[model samples]
Target: MKSSFFSILQRIGHAFMLPIALLPVAGLLLGIGASFTNATTIDSYGLQPLLGDGTILHALLTVMKSAGSVVFSNLPILFAVGVAMGMANKEKQVAAIAGAVGFFAMHATISAMLELNGLLAPDALPEGSLGMSVGINSLQMGVFGGVLVGLGVAALHNRFYRIELPTTFSFFGGTRFVPIITALSYMFIGILMFYIWPSLQEGIMHLGALVNRTGYAGTFIYGFIERALIPFGLHHVFYIPFWQTALGGSEIIDGISVSGAQNIFFAELASPNTQQFSVEATRFMAGKFPFYLFGIPGAALAIYHCARPEQRKLVLGLLLSATLTAVLTGITEPIEFSFLFAAPVLYVLHCVLAGLSFMLCHLFDVGVGQTFSGSLIDFILFGVLQGNPKTHWINAILIGIPLFPVYYFSFRFLILRFNFKTPGREDEGQETKLYTRQDVNAAKAQAQKGDQVSNLIVAGLGGSSNISHVDCCATRLRITVINENLVDDEMLKSSGARGVIRRGTGIQVIYGPHVTLIKSNLDDCLHNAV
Candidate 1:
């Protein structure tokens, strides 16, 4: 079967997620480091005596924060490895080597090309330049460079992982050829980028300036587009540029500059404060805190309240869990999808209100950040722990409080008034069963320690014999089975699945953010199958 454009994009999005999982700890460490290092924070709070300079506490805290700092500092490499790992079907570690090689070569070659052309400099390079240690040497392609190298390496891995070569050069065939080709291929890419990037950086800088100049309006537009595009899984397209490129990235933090919004925030947090935290630098992010931490969950309450009293129990478990997930981790698909199909108008309204939240937060000058999503986890790690008297992070709550009512009254009234068929309101003809405690225990036992979840999921889908192929993109595990009758939907749900969809002999097992792990586990299950 031919894949569609949507499928290709979904796969790329999944690839993007491979490295995103590293942000939370980085956020936490950076927050703590920033809070302590700020002479004002300690002096104002009167912790000056204990956390003063030359104390072990201060030194230890600095070390802890540096642990997280290095991850973002080397993010270009992370992206290359992540994209390679995500795209490769097998021999992932080998592909990663190719990615690393390609990335280094691309950046180094670009640097050399620039030096030759006199278009670049070691001292006065552009702000988006990748490496300089504040001066500039090489490897300045940033996230865009990382992506190019990753894609290049992955394409080679997938196409030539099993290619044959003449007997004399057989040693260079298969996995061995990957890194060699990656290095050679990126030279051309580097040459192209050498000429293109200066102009590209200018364009990106202008775009970033445009958004920055718009201030609150730009934030609202970003929030609106982000939420609006969620249903199509294109929200990544809306945010990635802002998050990764010079557009919304490239802020100085703690003395060391960084790229990407979240990384910049963490980096900024750990750096010594010369001035009050800059809201302008963090404008792309601060608004999401309110929407994710409070506003969206308030919408969940509105949904539950509007659910039919009789069927409410059936959905309460799912809704509550979904709400908690949104509050804690900032994953909202379960809750969003609950009403997205039934009341799409409400989704539009949600996006608009979310936009309003962003605009309001910006106007108040409240700023905070998170690595992955907007959640209370972010609230605590990036907001509360990284507290500054000057930062209006607490204002997130004030804006968030109104949203609950806004979402509740609006959704409740609309659902009742227009008869939106959200959740419990669905016709009795649609049969639904929430995963039960008994089902949970069964799946848990079946999914053993090493490959427990993987094996149980395999069993649910009728095991190795029944499954002919397996692949995943983002939230769902896409599988091909020989017989549909052997697949058990309840079993899959019991195996910690969010949901299941079947089309012919193809099945999709929804697993939310951990789908990558599940896909790996499933692969392991097949490798160890009985």
Candidate 2:
């Protein structure tokens, strides 16, 4: 069951990645359109265009804006299709159709409820009157709604795809049943949303307002909590306030507002309303630029320098990729996960740095927002379109360069001082020795002797029965065992694992990138043993 859950999560990640990868294209289009508009305004002010305003430029701007608008408007549809396809095993087309059906069903259902509520007089209606407004469209159509649609579609597709039908209704058998089931399911979902979505939305807005009222301290808490909640996939809950509602968002339409840290920041950039506290509240995010773009990379450099002589090159390669990701996209998972399961103290340090960065940015009033986190892409765009256009964002980069080195040296010194077994710092006996062909042959000969090394590993961990779940990512066998303490580290090491890690009630065995294959082998071993 644990493995299956992880598998679902992996599929969801893949689904989300597809649409997310396409976002840069949307950004480029929007940027170009904004640039064109700027150029046109400048020309109107009697400035001669180096590249004259021809039909070509005008046409290109129109196309880019149109494309961007389409992408922005249909994000929910894109999400549904992406998620369904990612989750489906073989019949992607069936899943896609189911996704579409599910989306429209929820949309129609929500629209109907709002319309119905509008018909009833206030005195005759329930308190809050369902807070349902017709033609109410949310930014990105709500991630939760998209996920529900995808799950609904996938479930229907999987369950009804092979169901036999009466001869008269045979046409609706198999994949065809998906859309029918999806439409029906959404009616119930719509009714639930009518009663629930308003309160949830208001609650989120209240939370955002509360955070805003806390000022710099609130921003610090938000940043720290966001990082800490990552392991449980609950970061989204905290992020919703900054991204979805009016409290932390901007008034885009006539009466509607959009909130989220990014939303608020962008709203401030697009239209600065100094009177509104929400717009001014975005200063909290500005301080994060230096830390994400520089400090994390600096920490990576420290890890590389502190690595054993033989492992320095390997560590450098890993840190390089991780650093590049942090700088370009603000995706710090690859870097964070490196020491997160090893030297937890460093992870805590990262959390501290993150909080401090936000506080400093808020103090300096240097603000920018990104779709992801504080990465180079968001940094550049936000800098160019800043509310405080006179502020020197370049200074943030200048400050970051030396800061990176400081982080590196300090981390190296601390790790050495504490004798922490971070990555390559393990004792000689615990070190992983790579095997050549000759060594493989020697090990094979030893295995031929009455030495069941694999069985010993299983036994040391309280046998196959003890393993409640097993999955993996790039470098570790993520396992949920009956008792984390039952797993002997020495036995796992003898079986060729690089290391063992524990978090809460979970245990992870390091097997590098090949951990996936190891997880499969272990699963087979367990099943056969049972």
Candidate 3:
């Protein structure tokens, strides 16, 4: 049962990746376009007309603005689609239909509430009132709404996908039933949001104002708290306050101002009266440039170099992939997780560096914002979009250069100093190699003949009763045991586990990508043993 639950969680994580991948691209385009607008307006002298009346330049500017608007305006739709796709079982078509249905339902519900409120208030209704727009209409759509839609769709899909219908209603059976059920489910969701969303929004805005009052200290706190909450996927809650509130602008809630990195940056770019303040204050986000564009890759290189001589080739390939991902999209998980659990000290160092980078950028007044992390893509976009693009961000690339080597060498020295068990630095005789095809076939044949390798593994790991959790992802079997001491190293080795690693309160068994299949087999063995 524990194994089954873990398997489900793994699938959910995999599904989420579908939407997460597209975010970086959206972020890149939005950042670039925003930067272009800022650059053209702030440094119009550098932007000359290519032809009469500067039609080409005007067209280019229009396209950039359109791209920015699309991304910002349709964020809710993106979230809905992303959630639906991530939560589906087999047919993504069902998920897609459900997403669209949910979007419309929420919007319609909100609009209805607005009309109802106006009718009830009559004379109290404000003049020139426009009805509320619903669904994932803007960045205001919120992650909570996306998750609600995804959950509703997944539940409907799983419950009704195979249900037999009355003959009269047979036309809507199976896949066709998905959209109907999804639409009905969202009706309640919409009604709920209509009444609840306003309070939630107000609360978030209030929180933003309180944080903004902390100023630079507040920014540092936000950065620290954001990184801390990443493991549980709750960082979005912490982020929305700054991104959506007025603290960073002239907007006020309960007579208090709200200012966050994104809010401040946008205000600086868009508000004519406050353009100068925006240029200087936007630097709160600039410090991340070095960390994203150079520091991370440098760390990856360091890890590759510190790998054992025999393992260098394999580790190099892994780090190279991770490095490119970090540089392009600012998704650092693949690289960060590589050593985070194995060598926690290094992870702490990374967090510290990240905080410092944000602080230094703020101090230097180099401000930029991207949908993702502080990568080269955002750097260019933010710099180009600045009110005083040349004055504030000229030194970004220069900062990144020295920071790269500092990250690389520092990571290398730390790994060596601590003899950390990162990747290839495992203790002697600890290396696990993939079995040859012949060897695997031989094991399977022997198993049929009643060889007890499978049984032995179950017993050695304290049987089914001792297993608290069992999960697999890509290349490893993530397990939690009732008692860590019950896992015998030699017994697991003989049963074909390539390697074993223990961290605080958890253990990992390496079996490469095939670990999932092995995990299923192991589950069966443990269950039968019980």
In model 3, where is the ten-residue run with the lowest total lDDT? 128-137
**Model 1 lDDT-worst window of ten:** 431-440
Model 2 per-residue lDDT tens digits across residues 371-456:
54577877776564332343346656665676687678778887888776665666787542322233335434545653354465
Badly placed stretches (over 4 Å) of model 1 are 1-3, 118-130, 133-136, 249-258, 429-475, 478-530
Task: Supply the TM-score for candidate 1.
Answer: 0.84
lDDT (tens digit, per residue) of candidate 1 on 1-530: 32334444555666787777776777677667767867877887888778988888889878877887877777778889889877787898999889988887877787787678675654566554646422336645567777777888898998888888999999999899888888898888888887787788778778888888887888889889888877655577578777777777576665445666655666567666545456765667777877786777777777777778887887788677777877887878767767766788989998999889878877887767668778787777667765655557788888888777888788888898899888777787854332334444544455565667786788899878998767775456867677879999988977677567665576777766556667876787798774
TM-score of every model versus the real structure: 0.84, 0.70, 0.66
lDDT string for model 3 (419-452, tens) is 8877677778865133233345655664676546
lDDT score of residue 78 within candidate 2: 67
Candidate 2, clashing residue pairs? 242-259, 242-260, 242-261, 243-259, 243-260, 244-259, 249-258, 249-259, 287-361
* Each prediction's whole-model lDDT (CA): 0.74, 0.60, 0.59
Strongest candidate by TM-score: 1
| Winning candidate number (lDDT) | 1
